[model samples]
Target chain A: MNITSVPFLFLFLPICLLFYYLIPNKKSLVLQNVFLLLVSLFFYAWGEPIRIFYLCILIVVNWLLGCFVDGKKGTKLGKWIVFIAVLINVGSLFVFKYLDFTLENIGFILGQELPLLGFTLPLGLSFFCFQAISYVVDIYRGKVKSTKNLLNASLYLSIFFKMTQGPIVQYNQFESQLISRKTTWTGFCDGFWRFAIGLAKKMLIASNIGYVVTDIFATDTASLPVVSAWLGCFAYMIQIFFDFAGYSDMAIGLGKMFGFEIPENFNYPYISTSVTGYWQRWHITLGAWFRDYMFYPLTLGPAIRMRKFLAKKKVNKNVAKFIQNLFVTGCIWFTTGIWHGATWNYVVWGLINGAFIIWELYKKPLKNKKLDSALGWLYTIAVAFFTKAIVCTPDMGSAFSYFGSMFGLNGNSLVSDTTLFYFREYWIFIVIGTLACFPIYTKIKEKLVNNSNNSKKVKTILYGIETVALLIVFIISIAYSFKNGYTAFIYQKF
Target chain B: MQEKIKEILGELLIGVDLSSKTLADDGYIDSLIVVNLVSELDLEFDIEIPFDALVNENFNSVEAIEALVKSLQK
Candidate 1:
């Protein structure tokens, strides 16, 4: 059921689009939504036949909870209801995603062998659960009114475009679109162009470079040559960005084709001058989610309380602020890490990122533009390299060994045949991948539009060129997709 | 109230311009600064800025912040 598969591209999407647009009454929102809902359910069930039932029950439950929580704003009952809703959503996520990991650790601590309950995780459980929680919370906070229609609720949480991996659209942001939307020929063309670009990014770039990354990591980290280690890490850095961002582009493109606008996720994250800036651009929706839902709440609630208590005790003002910042940053990162997976490496990765971000906060390296831009970028990339290494490695031991090789700390050669071979094979993809990390195409498009000066002729020519380029990209991407069988998006696991 | 907010923002952000209309959107103030500003405003005005009022629009300018604080105080 990978979206890049031939069946999906040729059969499922074409059929779905045909039926959707073929509906006689384009103005009938209910009919369109009902059609979309059924299709979305079918998409889910097609992938996870048994887990579709779990998703349905959760959807109905959250819909009912949203109903109950609405109009009870500022009351204790409303607060409790929202809390229970969050509990149900997060509890389910915990049971499916984290229970086994938690139990194993507990067993280790208690010196008893505990039997593991092997429950298969449903696809997109993490994503939909977050959306469900946001729906109830937004209702309770009076940000968005609860939908009385179960269809709208189901569609909101289980929309096929965003269900699997997301830009994590907030309920308030998506509620309006669900009610009223317009599908135009122009919009569909634009969506198709975007989807074509995403497909190219994935098939032409990410998948091509990914083979080298996988092969390098499969080698013994301790014996990995320094050049090979660096090469693998560098390739991985590109692979992950294109893989996730490309998927996001496809999802966004699909949304546009259906008259929905999914939020932008990645915004040239690799060009960020600081770690803090990097987070702002990378996986933007997730960062915003953490900021709005977790960071702000913790800051306004416990961090503020702790600060006040420290102030009352006559603690130094700066010291109190520092401690508060540390607490907030620590909590956010710890959760952010574990949210990626039920692995200690992910936790470590999160904490490492958090530490670097906190350092930037205090240092304010770019505040006065004091640090040179080139140096700042280098520093940020260096941090990213180590963090990406941590993410790709299986465990701490492997990560350290990889790092050791990367720095020539391990008794490993500087250059190896593997490194030379990878460079020889993937140099073009590597070069393209690196350049594609920036907004080069966007800049070019902007330049064309700016220079066109409202001339219809120039506009027409630009459009023609864009269309042709997109067609070429699509054809090549289709070829690559066929050559490389179904490759799952990296973020799909998260 | 506007002057008070400007003063607090000035103290926290050092070289940032407080008169800009899109402080948050323009990246003049990040989340850390926003957290500190919220805490400061809460203590200064003795008003709890509800989470719903914590959107970017309310914090994107000194005037907007003043308005949010005034409403919360009421």
Candidate 2:
């Protein structure tokens, strides 16, 4: 069930917390882990009862394989086990996620209607499988030791907070906490506060903007005005960032409540001056995962090997390295795009991102020392404004048309009543969400909380005010949730 | 090796001189620069840095890069 839902907020979470705290065993956390596992299973089952079976089987298989893969690392058996794990994990993902895309393409090519397996993708199957693969690969690499404890492995793979909408925490990151973490009052308070903020962000900000996006997208783009087109796309940027980032905040907050220190996902991504910087900030964990698992292995492994071979053949060193990097870059970004969805739009979006990043990579040394950061920020924003439309549109042609409409090149008016209405209604959300995208709030919070000159009484009053503000935000968010609006998370499909 | 590393870094860096003993001390190389440096060193030194070898200390300075390359060459 969604964390924002009434049942989850009022029933599941409270009951889960009650059982969790009451179930004793202060020192040994075996009982705690099991309790979490059972509750998490119930959570998963509540959403996708069919998917939970697959999830359980996958977890068991990985744990079993992990038993041998750790000690025998680099040996034939260890290497093979790791290979099998990757194949099974990634292979299942490919079949479940991409099989339809492949079949549809083949059908067009062959001039025949192919029978398609209309599969309802198991909830979080891609994420579940990816995490499992990450675990097994870590074991083989000896980054983390394999464990006999099924509960430990299970908990790592199926932690309730991050299971669906993920920052994709690595295997070694919080596994220690899963074993023996000391939950503190401070941690609980921090988690609650973070959860409240994320709830407000999602419920109040994302949900409100989402309505504007849906209305704009639902209107035929052929007649959509230039200003309306731009506004709609920008609204999407706000909707998606707050949506995914809010989910990440909740995940991290819940992890904190469990005394697990999950990593932050977003760090003012809009402030990034470059596409590379954007990737580093936006969906930080996903970028890291691809870099570590896919990009590095591809680059340092096969791509480097090929480049070296080319260099041996008397190819210019710089040229060889560039070619290899470009080739590897293509693969990494293409895979990244596919990971988002089984759509050509996503693939092109991914490619555009990759192309921009590679362009920046080459442009690094050539950057003028005197170039203002505002110019870079403007460039980044313009790029996002154009490219993000592709993610919102159904296909590449529509994305291109939306761009044309934004420029008034698609026979659309410069100003429209719809655009003005949207601006009037959503000005507050747009203002708040856009401002929040910067580091302004974070900076102010840091200065206030970290002001050492403030007396204890002053600090206490500030803290009291902050706590009340957070509660009010939480209460308002709950009201919005109960207001029966469109509330599905954007990233749940991915 | 130090001189050669300085030369390579000089080319990679935008405006800063590589005279400082430590690159990080002067805020010369961010994480992106380090990745580029890894590729440059990989090609120049002809050493494939295992993913595990890409660490902060190894990429911290001119000397550290030189040392990392020498060790990898062995």
Top candidate (TM-score): 1
Best by lDDT: 1
Candidate 1 chain A weakest lDDT stretch, 10 residues: A363-372
Candidate 2 ranges beyond 4 A from true positions: A364-370, A445-459, B16-36, B46-48
lDDT of 1 by residue, B1-74 (tens): 77888888986765667788999888767888878888888777888877777778998998999889888888
Give stretches of model 1 more than 4 Å off.
A25-27, A364-371, A444-459, B1-4
Q: Please provide TM-scores, in order, for all candidate models, with all chains considered together.
A: 0.95, 0.94
Give the alpha carbon lDDT tens digit for every residue of A1-494 in model 2.
Answer: 89888888889888977777776648658888998999889899998987789889999999998887987866899879988999889878878888988899899999998999987677777778878878988888888888889999999888788888787988978667776787888998899888888989999899999989999888787778888888888988899999999999998888888777988999888987777778888888887788778776776667767766897899987787577767877897898898899999999999998898777766644366446467777888888878878888888888888888888887899888878989899899999999888888667767776775765766697788888888888999999989954488988888
lDDT of 2: 0.82
lDDT of 1 by residue, A1-494 (tens): 78898878988899989988987545688888899999888888889998899899999999999999999998999989988898999999999999999999999999997899987678888888888888998898898899999999999999998998987999999999988888998899888888888888899899999999999999999999999999888999999999989999999999999999899999898898878889999999889888988898898899888878987899987788788878999999999999998889999999998898777766633454645577779889998987878888888899999999998998899998878999999999999999988889878877877888676776788778878888988999998888887988888888
Q: Candidate 2 has what TM-score?
A: 0.94
RMSD (CA, Å), each prediction? 2.0, 2.4
What is the TM-score of model 1 when looking only at chain B? 0.93
